[model samples]
Target: MSSVRKIVSTLVFAALTITSFQPALALSRVKDLVEVEGIRENMLVGYGLVTGLNGTGDSLKNAPFTQQTIQTMLERMGVNTRGQTMQTKNTAAVMVTAKLPAFASTGNNIDVSVSAMGDAKSLQGGTLLVTTLFGADGQIYALAQGPVAIGGFSAQGDAGSVTRGVPTAGRIPNGAIVEREIGFNLAAERSLKLSLRNPDLTTAARIASAVNTYVGSPVAVASDPATVRLAIPADYKGGVVGMLTDIEQVKVATDQSAKVVVNEATGVIVMGSDVRISTVAIAQGNLTIKVTETPEVSQPGPLSNGTTQTMPRTKIDIDEGKGKRMIVMKEGVSLQNLVDGLNALGVGPRDIISILQAIKAAGALQAEIQVIG
Candidate 1:
């Protein structure tokens, strides 16, 4: 009996240790928390046409842009159209869009998304012609041209129409080639600036400390909660690439403010670890009402010559659920305790959402509550 008790005690201690070992704060790599300034993707857009759509393309009379673009394309191909009126239903006008990543070089291929810009039935099995994709500065940066790979299809018959996925938008892998590159040199800067996606003073301080410790010198400075400045060290003066690589690999502990997010449309509720609530009591119940109607026909007695008659009867019932039972939550309750208490109440997700809103309104919830549809 003594040996058995000792073994059980040891197992219980080990289990407790394992369960309590979770880090209250999460560790995140520098690369995910911060981004190098001036290093981002640029949006490129253009208008073009998609051809080879089997009889599902836009009507020429309805989508004039399709006819006009075809005419212009044909004219560019050295076709004379002095008095020509052509009609074709195998083409669609589309908007070509691509993201030009930083440091993209000439002759490099990139993917492009093509969306129907006019009233088109489907863009499946279509080929996009050469189109000039221009940046926001109005400078031509790349050219997009390739066969569109549509992920959806549509079919129609005398009965009705059926569509699977979106057939009007498609993607062309490696369809655009970069012609010009953005002028920015990473190694030329004396100091590199890292911008945090979510600004927090404590996280910035931790990052700065981690960098300084790793480099054995004070090369990183937390200029603000959102920005960190790093001066290039003499040994790394050859190139800032190595320093950036090291800085991005450092891991720092992260903490966020307590917040409770609720989505009413899907009835989703998310609570952070630090979420708490003051002592509060909640009582909720539902009332249901139902009405039933019945119609009956009455026949005249035999040989009485009485006319037939119809009678209507209605029944109504009202039911109030089991009397509301109040549940009291103590102050600074743990998430497990709160969840168990709510579960014992047997309320649904939507009911929980409404209860949380009421609690927040009553100033009992000790965290910010965000409600989204």
Candidate 2:
């Protein structure tokens, strides 16, 4: 019995030691917290024409640009329609857009979004023609041509019309093929910068510390609250790519300033876990006043020559909210306690918004209040 007791005690001690070294549950990987500087997507845009629109295309008289585009396209195809008054309802002018992903190679396919630029009723069952997508530098990078897939439909008669979803927008999967690649050499770079999505001084320092601990050297430095500069170590064999791959997986506990965001239009409230309040007294109530009008008809006697008149009777009542009382909140109250206390007062989101704003003005709320539409 004595030998078994000793083994159990040793196992319990080891388990406790391991648990103490484990990362916190709220910790996030470095990759999720920061984005590499140079690796990003580029936007590509182009003007194109969609055919087979089933009479939902732009009107040539209303949209003169569409007519001019059609004339230009016909002339390229060895057809002359400049002098002719052509009325075609089977085509639409559309804007094609796509995002060229990082490290994209030639012949790689990407999805494209198509939006009608003219007064076209719908884009369903339409096939986009060969459109050349261009980058910001005026260089052609991709070619898009595919059947447009719209999510909604539009149907109309003489009296009414029924439309669901957006009929003027659609998407085509694997519609664009890359013809040129953006010049970027990640492996050849000696250093890189990591930009935090949410800038925080403590979080940036923690990230730098975590990276240095992983590399067993002080190669990473927190240049600012929003950026971390990393110098590749000489002994790391994986180059820049390998260094990023290893360091991005390092977990770090993120910290932020306490803030409360409220959307007035939506009546939605969001409070951070770090939000707190000093000891404060709060009382919320509404004073209601109601007025009702009742009309009565007054008729003269049968013998007398008099006309009937309508008389108005009004009743007014006022309520001062006598049932509500003031409540005291202790200092260092957490987010959960604040919410529970507010709910106990029977106030809704709109009322809560007003109460929070009032608390902020009273210098009792320790967090910053941000009001959005």
Candidate 3:
């Protein structure tokens, strides 16, 4: 009873201290936490062919799609390949992808990524022909064309081959030209919505307060933890650009819940600033078993016609840490105290992971435990 009461008293004091000090260190920018609803990028994808490979291209016999695409491309350019057999390893079928940024206008150039879609060894020295990039709506938005800049290469020897990085993927800088515009009239809309990247009621409320205070009006309202509604001001009516510029620059304080993330594969443990632990006792030790084998040759008796024999010898050993002792962790331990306590146990990172898991299972850890990898 005495130990429990002492722990409870310590936790109460620590909670109060933590709450008072948080206001000084939780500042963040509005742009980092919230994003406008309609301001986003779109993914564009297209099928194209990469030519001028030194025999590392797709084999026409294995990938018929490559031959078909080449034939179609040539036919569109007034080339007659109808009755001719197209058997070549200098062309490869590839998928080109790019991102169309919001508010992008026609004639704007963007980079495109090219990846082989067929059995191609390398796309090192290849040129991507003219291809139309389409969005999810099946509308052509951009046209991509140029020589590919492969970041890696592949070489073969008589014995083996060596590859550095990804030889089947390449990039073309400023190779895609926007042909159509996807317009979003934010100025024409009556109200604007801000979406929180990580939804939290405290963060949403703080954002709303900051915007309202800066605009000197109660035009901003927190609809929920993930959404904020802002009414257009009279001065900025039909001119949402200025209002959004100011809103995105406003500074606000954000809040985070106590969490502990553990990566089992790498034996990494991360703890939040407000993580706490109730009074608990922990004792850890490792048991290791080792085995050894030895073979010996036996000789026949001096005068007897006995055959030579062999004898096998085996040895087993076990070692378990006998000096391990339980250590009691007091409640409401600070970050420094927690580190010191864990270090005092003289255990490695893997052992610490097991200890943390055991603590969480015993309901002594006062934070959400997330195990990944």
Candidate 4:
């Protein structure tokens, strides 16, 4: 009985020791925070016209295209203006644009944006005409037409013009109807590929292992750190969507590269999550200079027929501030500790950037440094 108890105790101690020194468990599930690939929104564009504006419409003299369109529209309403020239006020020409949401259905209404393309002063009080929206293939994907809802107002005078926001552009709520649907066939793929936002070998291998263990089969394999190839199985052959739905729900640990980001113009600094440094010492120095200019007049002694002359005088000065708090950063330190040590010296953000560069130059920092405006 005593020997059996001792054996059990030794096994328990060994298990605890191994667990303590093991690597950090990254997200063990499958999917990332964002969608991988072939899953996004589509853009649709169209041309249209706006009417019902107060005299602030397109000028027929400048935009003949507007006049021609109006004429054609009027003729369609049984008005004969083939050779007759009829001008109408309170109308504007505009271009319409909208984003087709992912997996849009036919006959579904969506919002559209309308912008005046002519010399119209405002589209605040206007209604858009029906226009067909086309995709990249020039095929009609949707139809847009609705009342304009300009959020700004404009007033003009001989002295100046004052306007806020964009009076020439406005959005119409549910003014466009989807006439066509883009095909997104996930089931058609006998095998699916999972692409990672970042490429990391450790993460890819972990994902392949987790999927195989969870599903009890080797359905997922890592092609590279950034791409994972998944085979469609028999149970999930006709259920690709279902399988993906389950796969995306699984979480995987994310790994980032070792990098240091600095913004000089805005004085911003960001340390990468995985940055580490070796045993290196860092020292920062600053230099400042000042120059002053003054003028003086030199007169001839006792006015001995000599003209007074003006002389330019200058003074130069340099003041070096004494170093404060010579801080020491140890080797193999984490980013959090490193930044905390620097911040303890009350280093300004811009100065921090300079110090970091100096550290990189001295081979102390083992991470990439990026500067942005």
Instruction: Report, for all candidates in order, the number of backbone clashes.
Output: 0, 0, 0, 4
| Pairs of colliding residues, candidate 3 | none
Q: Candidate 4 overall Cα lDDT vs. reference?
A: 0.82
**What's the lDDT of the predicted structure labeled candidate 1?**
0.89
lDDT scores in order: 0.89, 0.94, 0.90, 0.82
- TM-score leaderboard ranking: 2, 1, 3, 4
Error of 4 at 239 (Å): 1.3
How well does candidate 2 match the true structure in TM-score terms? 0.88
lDDT of 2 by residue, 142-230 (tens): 99999999998899999999999998999999999999999999888878899999999999999999999999999999999999999
- Residues 1-373, candidate 1, lDDT per residue (tens digit)? 9999999999999999998996665889999999999899999999999999898788888888788888888898998764677677789999999999999999999999999988888998999999999999999999999999999989999999999999999999999999999999888878888998999888888899999999899999999999898888767744688888877889999766778899999999998887899999988787889999998999999999899999998999987867657899999987777777888787888898898889899999888899888
lDDT of 3 by residue, 228-263 (tens): 998888676336888888788898978878888889
* TM-score for all models, in order of appearance: 0.86, 0.88, 0.84, 0.74
Error of 1 at 371 (Å): 2.5
Alpha carbon RMSD to native, model 3: 8.0
- Minimum summed lDDT over a 10-residue window in model 3 is located at 232-241
Off by over 4 Å in 3: 1-23, 236-238, 289-318
Query: Which predicted model would earn the best lDDT?
Result: 2
Looking at model 4, residue 177 earns an lDDT score of 94
Q: At residue 75, what lDDT does model 3 achieve? A: 91
- Candidate 4, residue 318: the lDDT equals 78
